[model samples]
Target: MTEFLGSVWWMIVSLGLLVTIHEFGHYWVARRCGIKVLRFSVGFGKPLWSRRDRHGTEFAIAAIPLGGYVKMLDEREVEVHPHERGQAFNHKTVWQRIAVVAAGPLANLLLCMLLLWAMFVIGKQDYSATVGRATGMAQAAGLQGGERIVSVDGRSVATVGEASMALTAAAMDRHDVTLQVVDAQERQHQRVLPLSQLPAGFDERRVAPLAGINWQFWLQPALVDRLVDDSAVRGVLQPGDLIVAVDGERIDAADQVYPAVQALGKRGGPGMIDLLRGGERLALEVTPRQGLDGNRQPVWQLGIGFSESHAPAYDTVLKYGAFAAVPVAIGETGRMAADSLGMMRRIVTGSASLQNVSGPVTIARVANVSAQRGLDWFLQFLALLSLSLCIINLLPIPVLDGGHLLYYLIELVKGSPLSERAMAAGQFVGLALLAGLMGLAFYNDILGLVTR
Candidate 1:
């Protein structure tokens, strides 16, 4: 319950901040174009709080927190006084209207860059993209353990997070990617990973794992930190034991222990566990036990818990001075924008799964989790969210800022405004499309929760 409330609160705060900036973009541009703005609202529905500005514009916070709008004086929506006719939005030139409509998304794009700049200045700490283990396709592609990934498809990546983003995007589109990696000898090598070979309908969230790549920072030593109360190996294994081998297969990482034990359990026999304790090598026989996992599924267990203190420390930080970060931020924003657009295209072309569509629930949970991680992480999340808003709003759909811009573009080409009947029809179509999109997003969110 506490987690749920935190998610809701953070979601509201994130959306509120982004929406205000977006609406302010519209309001500022409209005012600059000599349009009389009647209401500057942060949300829809009844106004929860409102105040009249000196210019007679009402500033308000409304009940709904999902979105916001800036209401301007338009001759189509209301009667404008003869003296104020020049300030009416509908009476503005087509070019002026286009600018006003496009400003909201443009504002979000600017906000994204600003947030990324702040994040870079603060520095994002993460693990280096070094390979600790390689199997299947990764091994086939000559990705070796101890090699550090330098770039993916010619785009340099400094951290595991950056590499993952690039790799996932490419994987979604089933595109082959080239990796530049450096070995311990400081020799650089290039390898092509045929992500195009990945099976269709693969889970979007697990691309890295599915690609058979595991990072060094994730490989915990198979050292027993503690044992569960009913541990099957409690008598055979001690807390200070360093597990060396299981069933004759060498065990290097704690993650390797589970699959080894599960195989032992399936064989219906005792397995030999090799360990080193107090400068002595010992081998013990222990039978695997069936236990319920977090999802209540039956799984083999040795019932050993790894220590959090044993986890690898962050080895990389992406930081720059305020002056240096500006260009980096702009470059990063451009890269992100391109990736987002590409993913959208892939989804539309049926190359990507609709499961990638996330709604408010996913946004809220991610926001809260990111905020908890660190200020840099939260800022990065906000930047990404802001970028997404910019791209989504710029899509040519009715009832959106992009839709308005589209209509204005048509007016420009035709030398007159679209008839009210045509505009209304577009609005209805826009609303229906928007509704369907929201429904799909919600459905994906619910499905994710259920599966988790």
Candidate 2:
């Protein structure tokens, strides 16, 4: 219940802030173009708070926090008096109309850069991109555990998030990527991930696992945390003991201990368990109890609690000076924009899954999670969201800012406005497309919740 409230609160805050900035952009541009702005609203529905400016423009905060709008005086929507005809939005020149219509998306673009700049200046904590285990394609490519990823396809990456994004983008295109890695011994090597070999209809969400890469951050050590009351090693082992070897097989990782003990059970004999306890090395003999597992399969049972830790130390910080962060932020935004455009192209070409589309529920949950992480994380999330808003609003679809600009451009080209019938037809089509898009987003969100 607490989590639900947090999600709702954060979603409201995020959407309200972004929508206000967007509407303010339109209002500002419209006023500069000598147009009469009727209202600048942060949300829809009944106004909860409102104040009219000296110019008779009402500034309002409405009940609904989902979206916002800037309503301007337009002759098309309402009859203008002779004295106020020049102030109507529809009376403005096509170029002025274009500028007024384009301002909202431009504001979001600027906001994205500013947010990212602040995020970089504050520094984001992250785990190193080190591989813990390799299998299938990764193993076949000579990738090994304990190697830290240095770069992917010539792009340097320091954290798992960066590596994942680069890899996922390439995977979507079914393109092989080159990797640079440094082993634990500081030996550098080059390898190729044959992403092109991925089977048809592969899951885009499971990029890392599908590529056979397991991160070291998720791999726990071989430390014993708990023992069951009826456990075979209950007398020999205690909590806090680090398992060193089992039956002469080295046990550096927790996963290695299970198979080694199972092999001992298969041999039908007592096995030596070498362990480190209280700075002292000891070897104890323990006989395993063979049993039918949950699936009714014969297996050995150790009965040791091996759950992962709740907290882990962040080993890296992506930070920069205030001035230095500007260029980095710009570059980051450009890269993200390009990647987003590429994803759209892939989706249109049917090369990408529609599951990538997410609705407000997913956004709210992620916003809450990111906010809980730290300020830097939340800023980064906001930056990405802002950039997405800018891109989406700029798409050449009717009823959007880009759509208004499109009509103005066509008017400029043909030396006249579109017929009212044509404009109305376009509005109907736009509303249908927008509704379908919203429905798809909601469906994806619900599907995700149900699956989880």
How many clashes (backbone N, Cα, C below 3 Å) per candidate? 0, 0
Runs in model 2 deviating more than 4 A are: 279-282, 292-297
Worst 10 residues of 2 by lDDT: 303-312
lDDT of 1 by residue, 364-383 (tens): 99999999879999999999
Q: How many steric overlaps does candidate 1 have?
A: 0
Which numbered prediction scores highest in TM-score against the true structure?
Answer: 2
Give per-residue CA lDDT, model 2, range 237-352, as digits (tens).
89998998999997767888889989999898798899999999999988888877789998997777665773657888999999999999999999889888988898889889
TM-score of 2: 0.95
Quantify all predictions' global Cα lDDT against the true fold: 0.91, 0.89
